[model samples]
Target chain A: MNATSCYETLGVVRDATPEAITAAYQRCLGELRASLNGPNPPPPERLDALRAAYQTLGNPAARQAHDAALSPPTPAVSADEGERRPYPFAFTGEGGEYFRIWIVNLFLSLITFGIYSAWAKVRRETFFHRNLTLDNSAFSYHGNPIAILKGRAIAVVLLIALSAAQNAGPFAYGIAVLALLPVVPWLIVRAFRFRAHNTSYRGLRFSFHGTYRQALTAFVGYGLLAAISFGLLFPLFYRQQRTFVLDNLRYGSAQFHCTASNGQFYGIFLKPIGLALAGMFAIGFLTAAGGAPKLLLPLAFGVGTMALMLFLLPYIRVRTTNLVWNHVSLERMGFSSKLAVLPYFGLLAGNMVLLLLTLGLYWPWARVRLARYRASCMSLLSAEALDSFVAGESANAAAVGDEVSELMDIDIAL
Target chain B: MIAADYFDGRSSRRHPATLGLRDGTVVVEGDFGRRSTALGAVEICTGADQTLSTIRFADGAMCEIRDSAAWAAELAGAGIGADAVAHAERRWHWALAALAGAVLIIAASYAYALPWIAGLLAPAIPQAVTQSISDTVLKGLDGGLLAPSKTSPQRQQEIAAKVAALAGPGQLPPHRLLFRAGPTLGPNAFALPGGDVVVLDELLALATRDEEVVAVVAHELGHLRHHHGMRQLLQSAVVSFVVGVYLGDVSTVVAGLTALLLESRYSREFELEADAYAGRLLLATPASIEPLIDTLLRLEQAHAKRRAADRGGLFGATDLLSSHPDTAGRVNALRAMKR
Candidate 1:
């Protein structure tokens, strides 16, 4: 995927008027609806994405931001942003202060037997959002605790039903697994909506507008293909999934455009698998030549697994971040991540060692370090003020769907 | 007077403004021109950001000051303050005190509360549920790694009768004594939380004496008596809870994986308790703890032989070979209690 600006995504030209943009957005939605292969209409992310494009293009202020980002040499937009230097996201949460809040929240949750976890969830989300600054402004979370509790109630009931099904008999368990297969895509959509709807930047809430049919097609349809092909088509599935989800995302009314390609996904995946295979071949040859007849098989298996994990895990982390962020843009403001394989690999491996050595007390520091690195590594390739681009949304998605998602522990958001 | 930055909330333009109190009103003068509003007209959010304090007008125009104290000073007499920062930044003493309190609470819960809860909940589970669990597990195992026991049916029944006789007076009559060929789970015996005691064919063949096999059954019986499986599950849930509280994301896959990884793993204490229970149960049998001790040492040796044979080394690295408690220590402890 390349930088297909929101205007292009909604099928509008650079100078399209507000009325023209709205007409284009509606046209885009209708085309999407006609293209749906299911009984259901487009998912909220799809509509939200189109709506975001409409919102931004419709508003004079936001339009100018997009225009400025599109044509940076214009000089007028950058002047208002105060500083033209590269701005990195910043986090100022101290372990000590957060620890106090964390422990209190934990203690309350324990006493309440998980009832207080909703409140804890809100507190923690709010804390992280408040600390994370993109440019000078920060993000905010506006999830409702009572609504989350209700969602959790539903989730717990579902979990009980699932657990019961597992022990009910083999036939019932098999049916349960098959039933859950179709629900995974729907759950992902709900989770995306819940997350996008609750998160806000500059008084404008985030939104997702992908259709349910699209998700079903991507997850279930491609899921079957991947399974049949030993996951070789997984890159294509990931490509579709990310495109639908990320491209449909909106911060206020600005539709996000994801240009991440399947080829890039394959590139990231295959490199690690290739490296691991090469190491495996070397180890296999050495052991086979040594004449340690009895030891050969077990050592090959163990060392192969160890090498694959060592190479694959870090490779995926770095390359996937580069693939996603470097290809994705909100309108014309590009998102980029500078994560390297070695550093991240070292961080994860060392963190594991530290966690084991400290008997888990190092978790807080480890978490902070990871957060700081990720935050610092991510940067926006824009000089325009980020807040100026997204216009406020009018639609309201109830808190229930998001809460339900929370209960199910579904997460694809960043 | 506090001169701070402002945005119209509709445009990206910044307003350089000086803010002051005017009795019943708050006055602001900036490059966008002078404007005054009733003090109640604006919503004041202190600590909206760690460094920025926000004042939002009903009309969507907003101003933010960097110094929280400076913003608070202007609004001190108005009594319209949402001091979220002061609340978060309690004294160092309070922070330390809370830390100590939290640590104590976590420690106490893990040490006592979890075990108590598991104990309370374990008895309520019906035999039907446990039977279903055993059936599913055995059925799944049979389709793949496990085969029918090659041992003669007559030998199987003889051991089954011993297990049943030993389990006769127990709180839980062991749900079922099952056997499977041991290609995968070599020389292993385990009790699922549902009370089924499964002995592998390899372990059955390795034990030359019936007393040795009976001792293993008695040990498995101890696990059932204390509901070790259920307790292990509960303990893992509690560990996940602790992790969730700290990470602040209970819903993430990473968090769930962490919980799953921790859940089925037993602590050294659980293993020791099970061992002690087995020792007490076998005292009434013909060989006392001697056979149990002999079985433990032999199993350890058998496990070492398998690993050493496969890897061409590291018989000394027995710790890595097994998740079970140290067999030598267990044997010594069993010997010490042999009076």
Candidate 2:
């Protein structure tokens, strides 16, 4: 079938301004309307042809393609495209294979008593790189093996030191040993940078900039908060951790942006905690009131608290992390939002209480909450325009491919 | 020009143009006397001949007429299509709600049944009362149920020797027993219910020091006297009989017990009755009151440590357990002389 030509329907020259194209489209539509209801009405076929022509040319991508087709072809190919033609890396069981690789790596590390953590790390990196594709271009790893080994070696040493300190005595040297745990965070940052630098998509090498000290500082801050609040501050702690990780992570040449609104996010996070406290207070007051009536109050309070938290928790998370997208690229995307405290607390408390009461029946409940929470925090958009080239068509025709395709074989003469 | 008039309720104007004919068709002449046939219909033509004549239908239908003064109005309202709006899945939310409901059910069951069970079992078997009855039975066998004479200093030493001999070499010496006089304490003697027994001084005065005191001490020894103390330790350590009694019905017990344990305060009378049984048992032992009396005093001193440890393990706080009776009261009762 002959594809519709977007440029002809829009009545624009090859180098027409976007404004001029729009005006011409409006004029052509006006003329078509006049012809349809004039003293002599146009045939039904011509009316259908006009509608199809308008639809195709109205879309932007098809019009751009059609314009590109009308331009003269360049003799020389771009350096990037010439050196690395996009490759289609198709594997029948890609998802399953990646999952198996993760499982096997985990199992091997476990069997070897964590001696294989370094191997597992490399395997994970390879799996991730292999799966990532851009315009049929698969990423390849060119990371330094020695750097990875060095990072892993540092991590292992720290782990051993921590273990030795914990086992030395209940009190003696344990605190001193724990002080050295910050080294692990530094090693992780080094390892991430090493891995990212090795990943290549069409020769555009991926890199990340993160500091071990920063990660460690964030961890300590989170720990302190958790301790001070008697673990009630877990939601806030997690939010900080998430923000740190996301902000620190970089893909290819782009860096992610992370910003959180403390007040708005905390409002959501503290909701469940407030509800729980209120329920506890109510139960106490009712018990003090005395008689059979006092006995029923606690039960009602518990049930009501649970019900309210269950509904509000998800709502709070979605509202809190409905991230606003300020920037994105073909190779990278950044997200920023405030951490929600109340929803996290509600979800955590409600799930824990329910799980304890029901043995394990609430596993699915926990799973769904986690899934919804993840969905709330994540948003994806393709940075590059979705454009496909037609071999024989002009750029303008390609750009307005939809419009031209819709007008195929139609009689434009009235 | 096609003209029609109608009243519009929403508009402030008294009369408005009512477009569209009875058959939903409107045909009018355009500029330069050109005849235009608008498909649907037009009923009202109120403006000048140069006004853009158009047809608007009930179903959001608006078709522009070219340079026409009059045209049909086929009003068509734009209704939202089914595909345009997406329905949200509330299944996950509902599942979470159902789980929360289940948690509430279990918590409610625990809260309701536990206290009822505790109340039911508390009245059936009073540990203090049973121990007192056993003490009375042993005292009758010992020849004097009321009073036992105080032993000589030399005799006290000899009795200690005999208890030490019976205990054997490598073993620690038998706990001492003490005898004190107290008329209001009644005919009861008690093994301290821990590691020693105290014989009442009134009962000691009623009998000569040797055989009666020996038999009383022997009976008290039957309890603390051997692995019985160990048995009590094991029972108290391994089982939560109090909790079991309170939480026997799994459905309605847990929630109630948690609430009670977290909130309730026990009475002072409960401690005194337990002490009465210990006094009665000491009177039945074949040993002297010196060991029992010494142990009770030592217990009173060591009681703080035991309480601190228990509170640390159970509630992780000491202030919460402050309402319970202190050890000083029981020690004072044991030291009281005949009055």
In terms of TM-score, the best-performing candidate is 1
Q: Per-residue alpha-carbon lDDT of model 2 for B1-339, expressed as tens digits?
A: 343222111111112233333233343332213223344332221111222233333321222332233332232212211121001011334334444554564355345444344444433444564355445544553554334445466756665565454444654324456554434333334554333566665445544444444444544565543324333332332234434433443434674545445433222333443444445544444553444455444434444555554654444223332233555675566446212
lDDT of 2 by residue, A1-414 (tens): 225455454444343435445555666567678877677876766546555655545567765565576544223334323333222223111332333444444445545545665555655554445434333333445434444445445544544565566656667466854664564455445444554555544333445555767767666767688889997776676566556655654442234556654554576668766877787777677678664474587678678765765656555545645532222222222233333656666777777777678654454456446434543433334332212110110111011211121122211110
Candidate 1 Cα misplacement greater than 4 A, ranges: A1-86, A281-304, A383-390, A398-411, B1-13, B16-45, B48-50, B55-63, B72-92, B127-339
Alpha-carbon shift of residue B170 in model 2 (angstroms):
24
Model 2 per-residue lDDT at B291: 48
Error of 1 at A341 (Å): 2.7
**Residue B226 lDDT, candidate 1, scale 0-100:** 84
Q: What is the model-wide C-alpha lDDT for candidate 1?
A: 0.71
DockQ, per model, reads: 0.17, 0.01
List model 1 lDDT by residue over A279-325, tens digit each: 67876787778855767668778877776667676677678777888
Cand. 2 Cα-lDDT: 0.44
